[model samples]
Target: MERDFKMTAITMAGLEEVLADELRKLGAQNVKEGIRNVSFKGDKGFMYKANIALRTAIRVLKPIKTSKVFDEEDLYEAIQRIKWERYLDVEGTFAIGAVVNSKNFTTNSHYISLKSKDAIADYFMHKYKKRPNVDLKYPDVKIHIHIHKEWLTISLDSSGDSLHKRGYRSATNIAPINEVLAAGLVMLSGYKGDENFIDPMCGSGTILIEAAMIANNIPANINRKHFAFENWKDYDEDLYFVIQDALLKKITSSHFKIMGFDKAPSAIKKAQQNIINANLEEFIGVHHVNFFNSKKEVFGKTTILFNPPYGERLNINVEEFYRKIGDTLKHNYENSTAWLITSDIQALKYVGLRTSKRVPLKNADLDCRFVKYELYEGSKKMKKQIDIGE
Candidate 1:
């Protein structure tokens, strides 16, 4: 636990590079981006910091073993060879989740999980005359199995439940964005708290909360209830607290405004409550006004990032709504940069303004795009001065 070890951070499909950047900033070594995951080398203290600090990561996995498996028996034998006692005990509880991406394995992933669990149980039974019980909901040890075409990896879920459940948001809207996705969008939009930020269609204030956290340098999971590593046999309470204190001490004041606007009164209320819950009321504000009817309140340069109705969430005229968005940004929100994420790509054509950047992203099961529209000052000639990559 004192030495450097390999760790993998799982993220959204399009956030691998973002997660890698975050890991590198946190002093992780040998950071590499893979498909929906980032692999890095860090000691146990870095592991603790990554769990609490990474904004784009979903879960940090500490791989205990990796091997090539031909069949179910190979998987079981490989898992059994591990010294499970190091991570779990007879009186403790454990759970396993299997992810299978293989043509050779036709069995259900749940069946694979059961087989792996059985292997561990048999190993402990033969060795110590007792076995750990399965506690699916609140397990002391959580194991994740990944089988990518016969290559098997067993990892311990250090960040219990996803890190998306950052514990500050006690309320949620009907179509609220995932917390990790919200934070990732803000990070990808390149807003570093240097300028004023806004979420015109903020549903439950997730983007606003995440933006405030980013600006203030707050640990992403500071409010999280628990992490699997807390219950590990080698858990270091003092080290974890030291890391937390260091991260907390790094928080700096944000001078710029972070605001959100929603047409619905309920959404505004929920957003306010969530902002207050995150202790970010000083930095964020929620308003119950339709974004289309309102002008940019902030005088200086503004960074607007929002997830408007994609015609799927909340009924709206997709074409007309996108048109209005384009009009509002082009006319009222001058000298600003606006970014929006939507699954309705075809509807994007209604927004007449040319997007400077179009990033392909995935939100849950829907294929989405995170697009950026530059709102230049003055006449149309300003568009020529702006660059695509700028």
Candidate 2:
């Protein structure tokens, strides 16, 4: 590969800038942030590194071609014009996912995917005697179509599954945070291998695992079995191994502790299992205890990041729960910076502590707020003045 081909990365909504900053740190060229996506330039090895290291990206795509399409016929013609034989064999199973945003095209994405699949199958059936099968669960080849108005961009999904499948999480209970979001939260918190970290409300240890990975400089996908590049026609195993070895060599030993506390014993068991699965048992410790009654005693300059249960089921008193969060942090965790994410805006007001930062984020489909509070040992007003050099 010439190392100059353009690549696109898709991310969760409102995380395009986050993904773009990550790519820039990885030395990607011509980085541009779009809505829920980032475009950059890299080679085959860079593609592998991006898959292994990126924390916010969902999938990395290599655009094969971009053109204008008016209807299904145009879509088929464009898909067929790209020599599919170069990328996959007639025996390989494949799947297509389409995203449409056009006024004239009211066709469902599933139908568009089916039409594109037919075009590929027909192309192979006409050229060869056999056609590939479609495997939705796991496919050797995955194609993506993006139609915006009249423009169509067809790309190959280099990340077969979503990047959130970091390969370490086998034990999960209710409300396990997404790996990418967890990593992003750690990044946004500005805790870089310094200070003790605690996810006091850790349900399945997702935040703790992500924090340990960041602190130890481990590759995000170190335990992953396969990347989509491994299935690419031009995959260079030796080059990939070289890159992997180099990345592994950079893994530093972490001395800081990452602790998780969950009130439910079942949640603690799942967290411990997940930590062990990630080979990070030494770095992370999980305890079964209610966070509201717990105090910060992790030693110097602790950073707490947690996601408390936002009452969506309408059974729990959300206002009271949030108020408890404020009381616990203010009374117990002095000299600490605590951050929490919740979708309940009404409940957030109950946590009466002044938020130092209010970051707008989304969890699943729910618009959420990621707020930070600075707990002080004495008067918060005096501490604020001291912090501001007043």
Tell me the whole-model lDDT of each prediction, alpha carbons only. 0.92, 0.89
Candidate 2: what lDDT? Answer: 0.89
Q: Best by lDDT, which number?
A: 1
lDDT, candidate 2, 1-390, per-residue tens: 365789999988767888899999988999999988999998888998898888889899999999999988899999889889999899898999999999868988888889989999999998997899999988888899999999999999999999999999998876678998998888888888888999998998999999999999998888889887788788889988988998899899878878999999999998998899999999998998899999988778889999888745336888788899999989999888999988888888899899989898989988988889988888978987998999
Clashes of 2: 0
TM-score for each of the candidates? 0.97, 0.96
Model 1, residue 327: what's the lDDT?
A: 91
Q: Give the winner by TM-score.
A: 1
Off by over 4 Å in 1: 383-390
lDDT of 1: 0.92
Model 1 TM-score, all chains together: 0.97
Query: Mind giving the per-residue lDDT tens digits that candidate 1 earns over 204-264?
Result: 8999999999999998998888999999999999999999999999999989999899998
Model 2: lowest-lDDT 10 consecutive positions:
310-319
